[model samples]
Target: MATPDPSITTWEGIGHGGGLYEQGYIGMAHGWSTGIVSLMSNYVLGVVPTTPGLETWILRWAKGRVGTPQGAIEVHWTLGEDAMSVHLTVPAGTKVNVQVPVKKGQFVLLNGEQIEALIEEGYVNIGDVKSGVYTADVRQRGSVACKPG
Candidate 1:
């Protein structure tokens, strides 16, 4: 079966009622809100954890969609003097992709080392990755000033 376009579908709410025999009534429906939230987190944010305790991570900018039209997810926090890190988990055997904001002359570091990346439209694209927990650190011109905080 084909999935309906959520943008134009009318979300129907399940209802419950009772007569002289039943003593329960239905509450207002809120499925629409739930579906929207799922779409954003699963498709837009694309940060899915597979392991029960978040032992594996998957970083996909936008999956099953053309673009992030809703804007990218941003997190800002300080780390001991000059350290910043992000964490995520994904299921095993699943291909993962990550989108990192980048500029010319900058590179991506997987584990304190530089790796070949595709630079496009002010973003660094990493693809063909498998399921696993990952921590990435970005540096510009050999400087750590641009690290996430």
Candidate 2:
């Protein structure tokens, strides 16, 4: 009779129950669990950005083909006096059918009236008043644009 190594026995017990084998599998599982945990934690903590001078907005757009699992699309944009940044996340089954126009000082008028006209016209007029960065984020399912007041 020989004694089995504790580490090997433990590994075998865990692995016998359809456990991960390679280190890469464990790492990937950890990463996914971490992401889910973080998202849940944020929701539980009510960690939303709220400030007078800073604005945080979330828009959920559903349209064409995207690359995510929920068939939903997320687009992020930030506009300030000197810079603008944009990021887009699209799920796997949706398609984004809008063309985002980007130009300096081009404001996205989200009013129903303005949006209707712009959608019909396919474009909007932009004038040069002050020099600032403009950003446009477009994906297969949605788009988002923002500017600081």
Candidate 3:
């Protein structure tokens, strides 16, 4: 059942239904979950994987949209049982680029470590690669740093 007000998009979930509407009803507040995950991964945690199977990756945090008075965000994650935990953080007005699973002799650092690149498939590629969250800030105007060997 819905209210008479057309502007009121909120509604109660009905236990009986099928397909998309049924799924939506089953998880009436699913958007909140997705939104929180998106905020943490894209804006707060800032973890973006590049290449298939996360062969490469990048991290960039946004302090403005975090809705907190603080000017930085901390991120922590684990890789495997043998690998050590990885932790990173970024403050307001700071820029950083990280690439994972990099191969030797494939990338070149230019402009006093402000730029990172490599020739992939005969193409000169830059930073902010793709896989999970897309970071336009790095691609637009930000320094690039390759993964340490």
Candidate 4:
């Protein structure tokens, strides 16, 4: 039964087994368990596999560290008014794609160098980025011409 304050109650809702009110106090908070695991893996750890067997993957570029068979991958980013500064460390032999949020026609930069491609579908699609530490930053169009690389 819910108390008037609700916060003062000893139990929350019915038990996992469904409405056995007499002995309904199940121990674990199920919702929080899922949040701590699933949410942590996707957003914080930023580990979303795009291909099977980890041959290639997508890095969402949020924060935190994750370990793969090659080694450890760590990413940290700082958001600014018009750009984001990302410091990334990828395991050797890994090839991953990086997605940065942006509007179409906007430009993207890695280590202060402009990328030739424009943003598509609300993101700048940077693909097949090799393993290594990098300083990535984004710049808008008209700031600098994209150099042929």
The model with the greatest TM-score is 4
Task: Estimate, for each residue in 9-126, the C-alpha lDDT of model 4 and write its tens digit.
Answer: 3333454565445474564334533455556766786777777776887664568778999999988976655556677888999987987777644567776677666667787777
- Give the C-alpha miss distance for residue 115 in model 1, angstroms: 1.6
Per-model CA lDDT versus the true structure: 0.50, 0.37, 0.40, 0.66
Residue 85 in candidate 1, Cα distance off native in Å:
4.7
Residue lDDT tens for model 1, 42-146 = 566676778765588566443332223333333321223223344434445454577766666666765455668777887667665556655555566656644
Alpha-carbon runs more than 4 Å astray in model 4: 1-62, 142-149
**Cα misplacement distance, residue 22 of candidate 2 (Å):** 51
Q: What is the lDDT of candidate 1?
A: 0.50
Candidate 3 contains a number of clashing pairs equal to 0
In angstroms, the error of model 1 at 47 is 17
In order of TM-score, best first, we have 4, 1, 2, 3
Per-candidate TM equals: 0.39, 0.24, 0.21, 0.52
Clashes of 4: 0
Sequence-dependent TM-score of model 1? 0.39
**Alpha carbon RMSD to native, model 4:** 12.7
Off by over 4 Å in 3: 1-25, 28-32, 51-55, 60-149
The residue pairs in collision within model 1 are 56-89, 56-90, 57-88, 57-89, 57-90, 77-149
Task: Compose the digit string of candidate 3's lDDT tens values, residues 1-149.
Answer: 13356763434343344223555545543444345554566655567767666578775432333323435444444343222222345455554464432233333332223244554554334443322222211211332443333
- 1 against 4, candidate with superior TM-score: 4
lDDT of 2 at 66: 33
Candidates in descending lDDT order: 4, 1, 3, 2
